[model samples]
Target: MTHTLNQPRNSTKSSSFRVDLQGLRALAVLLVMCYHIWFSKVSGGVDIFLMLSAFFLTSSTARRISRGERPPLITGWLHRFSRLIPQAAVVIVSVVVAAWIILPSTRWLELIDQSKASLFYQQNWYLANHQVDYYAFNTSSASPLQHFWSLSVQGQIFILWPVVLAFSVLIWKLFFSRFNFAWVAGAFFSAVFIGSLAFSINITANNQQVAYFHTGARLWEFALGSLLALALPWLSTLPEKIRRIAGWAGMITIVASGAVLDVQGQFPGFMALIPTMAAALIIAAPATRAWANPSGVLSLKPLVKLGDLSYGMYLWHWPMLVFYLEVSGNQKASFLAGTLLIAASIAASWCTTRFVEKPVIAWQNNLAFPHWMPSTGLKAISQIAVVAIGLGIASLSVTAWENNVEHRRALAASQTATDNPGATAPEDWDPAPAALTLPLATELADEWQTPGNPCAGSNNPDDERIMFCEQGGNFDGSPDLVMLGDSHMQHWSAAAAAAMEESGGSWILVFHPGCRYGSDADRDEAECANFQDAAEEYVADLAPKMVLTTASKTVAAPDEYLRSPGEQETIVDHYAEAIQPFLDAGSQVIAMRDTPRYTYSIPECVDSNPSHLEACDGSAHEALAQINPVQEFLAQHDYGQQVVSLDMTGLLCPEGVCKAVIGNVSTYLDDSHLSKTFVLSAKRQFAEAFKKATGWQ
Candidate 1:
C-alpha cells in the first residue's frame, strides 16, 4: 500500500507477474479515497493494502532465501526508500506549502509537525501519541496529511520485515537447517499474528483511538499477509472450481465489508480479517483464462494502469479533499464536487507518478557514482542519502518558516496586550486598534494550559485516573488551594496561579480532560467516574484551604437558552453531593460558572472573517444559564459562607455577547476553552473573586 506498483523482483520458480494483485492495489486506493470523500467511513481498504504490501514483500524475500541467496537487506532497503522518498517528499512539500496558503494559521504548526513525521515514517506514532481519533469524522478540521498514517505503518513494516526474514535465515543456517525456510518463517509470523491480534483486540476494545494508529496492533495484519504468501504455493494447487469460489467470495467480502461491518470502530482487530483474508483468497486463487476467473476483472488494463498510479493517488487525494473543504467551507462535498475532486486528484497523481516517481525510480535503477567509490552497495547508499538530504532540507525549511511566523506573532501579542485589556477592559472602554489579535491564531493551538509541575511524593495521588499537578505551591506542605474538575476548570488555572503567586500561596490542580468532578452516575466514561472518585478522596484527605471548580456547564446553539429553576436544581444537587467531602473537611469551595461553549472554533471563525468579528460573537444567554446552579446549591445547603459561587460571565461576555476577541485578545483557544492570555488578562477579577470567596488577603 505504501509502495504500490513496485513489486519486488523475484527470481524463484514460483515468481511471476501478479497483474491481479496490481488491480487489487487500484481497488484498495479507490475504496480509501471514495470512503473518505463520500462516506466518511472506513472501507477496510487500508487493511487490504497492509496485507497486500506484506504479501508482495514476503513473497519476494522468501523466494530469495529458499534459493540459497542471501537477502540483499541493506541494498534492498536503500533502493526501496530511495524510490519511495522522492515522491513522498514532493507530496510533503506540496502539502506544507498548500496548507500554509489555504488552512488557518492555527493548523499550520501541526501540519508542519505531521509533514516532518510523514517524511521519517513516524506519522503513525505521532498520531498515536497525540491521541487523534481517526474515526471521528470532522472534515472541517481534518489534517490533510492524515492519510500518511497508513503509509508510515507500511514504511515501518518495510524496514522490520526484511530484518525478520534475515534473522529467520540466520536461525535456519545455525540450527534448523533440516527444516525449510518457509516453515521457520511461517512459525515466526504465526507467533506475531497471534500475539499482535490479541493485543489489537484488547487495546481496540479499551481505547480504539490509540489502537487505530498503534503499530503493534496493526502488525498482525502484515503477519497474516506473510502467512498467506508462504502458503500460496499450496493454495495454487487447489481445484479450479474451489479457487474460483474462494476468489469471488473474497472479492465480494472486500467490497461489502465497509457497508456491512463497523469497520471504523472495529478494525485491525479480528474484524480486520474480513478484508485482509478476502485479499488473501484472491491472491491465492488460480490464475486462469476462463472468464469466470476473478483475475479477469481484477487484471483489466484500466485497473492495472490505476494500480500504477495508486501510490501517487493515495498521496494526492487527501490534501485535495481537505483543501476543497477549507475553501468551500462545506462540511462534506456534494456528488459533483466530490467527482471533480477525485478527477483533480487523479490528474495530479498522474503528473506526480509521471514526473516524480518514475524518474526517481529509473535514476535509482541506473545510478552511478565516481569510480573512486566503485562499490555497488556504496552507490545504493548514496542514492538513499541524496533523497534523505532533499527531504531533510524541505522539512527544515518549513520548520524555519513556522518558527519565524511564531516569533513575529509572539511579538505582536506582547505589543497588543498593553493596549488590549481583554476581559478586564471597562464596559465603555474603546480598544486600541491593533493589526493582530492578542494570542494570535498561530499561537491559539497551544493556549490550553498545562500544569507546569507534576504533583510528587505524598502530594501525588498515584492514581492513573486523575492527573495531579502543583503550581506556586510548597510540595512539603498541604496545598493552599486545590483546583478540580475537567478542562473547563483547567483553563482558568492561569488566573488561579497568578492569584496564588500574588498571595504567596500554593495550589494543586486535579483534573482530567473531559472528566467532570461529579457523582458516578453523572460521569459517562469509566475512567472519568474513577477520576471523580479519586479526586474527591484526594481533596478530602489533603483538606486544602480552598477548592475551585466549575459549577455549571454550557450547551452550544441552537437550543442554548438558559436552564429553568427546576433544571438548575438537578445540576445544583449533583455538585452539592460531589463537593460535600470538601465542606466537611473545613475547605471553602469556589464554584465558578463555566464559560461559553461554541459550535465552531472561534479563532478559526475569526481568522476566516477578521472583518466580521461581530459574527463570531455568541449570545451570553446561550453560553450560560441565567440562574447559577452553584448559587442555588449554596442557598439550599446549610454550609454557611463556606461554599460560594463566583460568576464572571459578565466579564467574559460583555453586554450579553461573547466576542471572539475582547480588547484585541482572542477569547478562546478553540471553541470551549478560554485562552490563557485572556484568562491572565482577567487576573484582577480572579484575585478579587478569590478574596471574596476564601477571605484571602
Candidate 2:
C-alpha cells in the first residue's frame, strides 16, 4: 500500500458532507493492510485513495479560485505539506532509530537512504529509477519504507496539483472567463486524463515494475478524480433509484476489486478503472436513508471514525508488519500473530492521529502571532520550518556517524595484511585467518566490480541486452574472448578483464540475470530465449578464441537441486545445446564451476555475528551439489577436446568447507556470487586455468 492525500470535507460543491468518503478511506486502508500482512496481494485500494485525494484537492482548489479568494501559493503549500509531514516524519524517525537498533549493519545504508527518501516524498522515483522489485515478499528483510512508494507518488501530486489548478485559473481568467472556472479546469484535466491514460497503458505493458511507481503513469488516476469533482453537480441531479444502485455497485466493486483483478501485472492501466471507477461512483452518489445506498453503509460511526484515522493507519500498518516479520524471524506469521500486529498497528495509528495529528491541527488553527497572516497558513509554515530543520540536522548527524564507522573500518583494513590472500587452496587451512578482520569483509562486500555490463543503464529485466563490449576492446588490437551466462559469470567480469589485460586480449560479456548458458527450454522466459539466441549468433560472428562462462546455478528450494542419478545429464544437454553455435564457429568453451551458494547473506551474517565468524560458514557438501553439474554434463558431451570444464571450487571452498572469509577476503558478495576483491585475489589461478583452456601459451 504505497499511500494518500488529505482534504477538508467541504472542499467540493456536492461533497458538503463526506461521511461516505471517510468510510471509503476506511475500506481502502483495511484492504491494503489485509493484503500486505497475510495475502501478499495487491488490493487496488491504493488506487481508490489516490483518486479520492485528487478529487478533494482539485475541488478545493477550484472552489478557492472560483471565489477569487486564492490564498498565497506558498501559504497553501506550506499548510498542506505541514499537515502531511508531521506524522510521516515521526514514522521515519522512529523507523530509522528502530532499524539501527535492531537490523544488521549491512542493511543500514539502504534503510537510511530510503528513510530519507520517504521523508522527502521522493521514494517512488527512487524505487522506480533503481528498479527495485517492489512486490518482492521479503517481509522479514525488506525495507519497511518500500511501501512509501505510493505515499511518495501522492506527495508529489499534492505539490503539483495546486500549481496545475493555479495555471488553469490563469488561463480561464485570460481567455475563457465567460465559462465556469470549474468547467474550464475540467476540460484541461480531462485532456490530461486521456493523455496520461494512454501513456500509462503503453508503459505498463512494456515495463509494469517501473510503471507501478512512475508519476507520469499515475497522473491519469488523479486527473480522473479531478474531472469527477467538476462533474459532481450534474452527478447529484441523477434519479434517486439510480443513485442508490450506483452507490451499492461502487461499494461492492471496491470490496471485490482485489479478489477479482490482476492488479500487480495490469495496474494503473485499463484494469485500474475497476477500483477508481468504483470510488468515483460512490463519491458521485447522493446520500440516501435507504439500506441499498452505499453512502448509508459507509457512514456508520465506527467506519467513519476508522476513515478519520486512515492516513495514520496506512502509515503504521506496513512498518508494523515488517517489524513483526523481522523480530519473529517468520516469513508469514500465524493468523493470531497477524491479528496482534494489526491490533498493535491500529492502536499506534489511533495514538498518532489523536495525540500527534489532531494536536498539530489544533495548534495550527489557534495561531494568532502573525496578525498580517490570513489564516492557518502561517502557522502551518512555521510548523513545517521547525520539523524540516530538525529532520535535516538529524539526517546529517546520522550520516556523519555512519561515515565514521566506515572510515574506521577502512583505516583498519589499510593497516592489516589480508591473511589468506587467496593464493592457493590448502587442505588443512582454517577458512578464517586470525589476522583477517571485519574491515576485510566490508571491503570485499563493497568490491563487486563488473566491467562492460550491458544492463548498466535504465534497462529493466526484459530490455536487458546480452552483448557488452569491453572498453577499448574494438580498437586495442588484442585477441577477443567472449564471456557469457547469468550473474554468476558477470561477477567474474573484473577478474576476466584483468586476465585479458595481461594476456593481450579483450573480452565481451553476454549476460542476463537468471539466464545461464542453457537450451531455449531451460531459459526462464521468452526474453531469456531471445537473449540466448542473439548471444550465440553474436559470439559466432565475433569468432573469439574462447567463450568463458560459468556453469554454477543455485535454486532457492532444496527439492530443485540436481542430485539424482543422470540429473546432471539434463544440465549438460541443455548447456551443450545452448553453446553449440559458439563451438561450431571454432571457439573453445571454458566453463567455470560455481561458487558455494549460501542460505543467507554472508556479509549480513558476518555483520550480525562478528566474533563468531564460524557460525556463518556452511557445510560445503550442502552448499554445492555432490557432482559438479557442468563437469558431469561435459564428461559425456563431446565438443571435441576444445571444450574445457574447470572446477576451481578448491580455490573458493578449500577442504570441503565454504567459509565467509578466505585469505582475508570475503568469499561471497551476497549469497552466491564471489566478491570482486576475492576474485581479483584469485586472478593468478584464474589466468593459469584460462591459458590451459585456450592454449594461449
Candidate 3:
C-alpha cells in the first residue's frame, strides 16, 4: 500500500491533463523547512503545509468519489502509515537507549510508556496538553511528535471525510446524477469550521499557546482546506488572470501568518483564514504560468527533492534538535546552522525511506502462502496480518530481554533506595527554637503525604498528636507551629518538624491541595471556590504565628495576565488586600516561587529521545527563562524582613541553561512542578538557602 511517491503510479493512472498542484507541494514543504530552520519566530511555513495537506487529500478523494469508485480507507491509512513508521521506530529505540544512560530511572520509565503510545499514533492528545506552554519562545523542551498533531488531524479527517463523502455520493446517485453535492458538503463542513474557529478565537484570546496545540481549537483550519477542495469546480473555471491573483493573495496570507503574527496573537483561530485561503488559491492556480511547473520556482530542483522526503524529515527533526540542544546547550538556532541541520535531517530521511521503509513494505506486499489467498487489490492486507503480529511480538521481546533475577533485584533495589519516598527524609535541624519554625511544619504527625517521609500529622484532633514522630522523637513535644499553604508546603512538614523537634514548634500545616497563596476576590484558579470564606475564617481562628505558601504570582495580579499595564497595578493591590491576615498576626512569611513548566508531558520527554544520557544534560537557564519575568512581582513586595525566598535557581541549573532534567533525570512530573526525584536533589540546596535567608540556623 505504500506507494513510491518519487515514482508516480505507472500501472494505472489518470491522463496528463493537469497537475499544476504538484508544484504547490514543493512550495509548501519549502515554506515549512524555512520557518523551522531559521524563522520559528514565524509559522507561515507550517500554515502553508497544513493548508496543502487538506487541499490534496480532499481533492484526491473527491476525484475517486466523483467517479463512483470506493477505495478502502484502510489501504490509504496503512500505506501512509507504513511510509513513516520505520524512521519513527529507529528514533524511539535510540531515545530509549539514550535515556537509560543519561536520564534518571524515574524519567526513563515514563519515556518507555510514552514511546509505546506514540508508536500507535496517540501522540497528538499527549502533545495537546503540552502546548499549554509548548510554544512560548522561552519554553524549553519539545516533543518528537509535536508536529504530529497535524497528522492526527489529517487522519481523523481521512476517516470522517469518507463517511460524509460517501453519504453525499449516495444522494447524488439516488436523487440526481447532475447534483452538486460539493456545495452541500462544503456548507456542512463550513458550519463546523466556523463554529470551531469561533470557539478557538474566544479561548486563544486569553491563551494562544494552549490554542495552538489543541485539536478542538484547530479542526476548523483543516475543514477550511476541505471546503476549498469542494469549491474547485467553480475555481478551475475562473479567469486565468483571477486565478493568478488568488494564488498571489494566498502566498501573501501565508507569509503574514508567520511574519506578522506574534505568540500573543489569536492563531489558527480567526487568523487561520489568511493562510488557509492562500494555500487553496495556490493549489488551484492555472497551469499556464511557467512558474507553476515542477521545474520552475514552485517546484525548483531543491524543493522538489526535499519535498520527496518531507514526510521523514518532519517526523525526525524535532527530536534531533532537542537532543542536539540538550547536549550542546544551544538554545537559539542560527540560519546557517539550522539549515545545515535541516539538510542533515533530509539526508537521514532519504536513507531511511530507501533502506527501511521500502524493504519492509515490499516484504509485506510480496507475502503469500498456501494458507491464504490474495483476493484484495495488489495484495491482501489480511495475508500480512500474521507478519505484523510477529514483528510486534519481536519488538516487545527485545524490550523485555533483560528480565532476569539479578536485573529484577537491581531494578527493585534501585526503586527502593533511589525511588522510594522515605529514603530521602528531610534532615531534622532540631537545634532551632520553636518560634522560628515555618507555619506549616511546626505541627507533626504521621499523615505527611509525600509518599516516603515517615513522620506525619494526625488529621483527627481527638487522636493523640503524632508530632515529630518520623525522626524518632519531639524533644519538647508541644504543638504550636501553624503551616499554611498548598499541598507542596504540606509535604515539606517532615523537614520542618525535624527542625523544630527539640522544643517542638506548635505547627499545623493548613493546606488546600490546589489552593493558592493569593487572597480571595481573585480567580486565578480556585482550589475550591466555595471554600473561600470558610477557609479564611478557619485560618483566622487558628491564628498561627506564620504563613508559608507557594503559588502563581499572577494570582496576586490578574491584570498582568493581559496586555493592560494600568489594569495590572489596580488588580494586584486589590488582591493583596485580601490576604492582610499574616501582617496582623505578626507572623513571618515565606513565599516559594512556582516552578518552571516543560512543553512535553513527563513521558514524552523520555519517548522523544533515543539516548537518555544526552537528554539529561540540559541547562536550567534554557528551561526556566520564562519565569524570569516572575522576578518583577517578587521585587514589588512590601513585606518587611519576611517573604523568604526558597530558590531552585542553582539546584535546577547547570552552566547557563535550566533544562527540565536534573542530575541525569527529568525533574518535573507535569508542566512546571518538580518530580520527587528532582525535588529531593534540590532539598539539600533548598535547606541551605532557607537558612541563609531566614536565620533559621
Give the number of the best model, judged by TM-score.
1
Task: Give the per-residue lDDT digits (tens) of candidate 3, residues 422-469.
Answer: 213243422212111110111112233443233344422221211212
1-697, model 2: which lDDT tens digit per residue?
0124333322323435566677789889889888888887789999988898888777666666667876236666666666777677777777877777677666777776787788788899888888887567784356888888888988888778878888888898899999888778888898889999999999999999899999999999999999998888888888977877787788889889888898888987889988999889888787753467787888787877787778888888888778778777788868898788778877887887778766776776666775676556566566677567546755764676478557757666565333445544454555443454443443544665666544322221233455443431432422367777777887777777778877666666667776777745456588777787777776676677778877655543255564532222224236666677878888888877766676687877776776787788876676667888776677777665678877777776668877787655567778777777678777888778767666775
What local lDDT does model 2 show for residue 387? 61
Compare the candidates by lDDT and give the number of the best one: 1
Worst 10 residues of 3 by lDDT: 434-443
Model 1 has an lDDT value of: 0.80
Off by over 4 Å in 3: 1-22, 98-110, 137-140, 176-178, 292-296, 360-378, 382-479, 485-491, 497-507, 511-538, 544-697
Clashing pairs in 1: none
Per-model TM-score, in order, reads 0.85, 0.83, 0.66
* Number of clashes found in candidate 1: 0
What candidate 2 gets wrong by more than 4 Å, as runs, is 1-17, 65-68, 288-292, 370-387, 390-409, 412-415, 419-446, 449-466, 471-486, 490-513, 518-556, 560-571, 574-591, 625-645, 684-697
**Candidates sorted on lDDT, descending:** 1, 2, 3
Instruction: Output the better candidate (1/2) by TM-score.
Output: 1
Q: Weakest 10 consecutive residues, lDDT, candidate 1?
A: 6-15
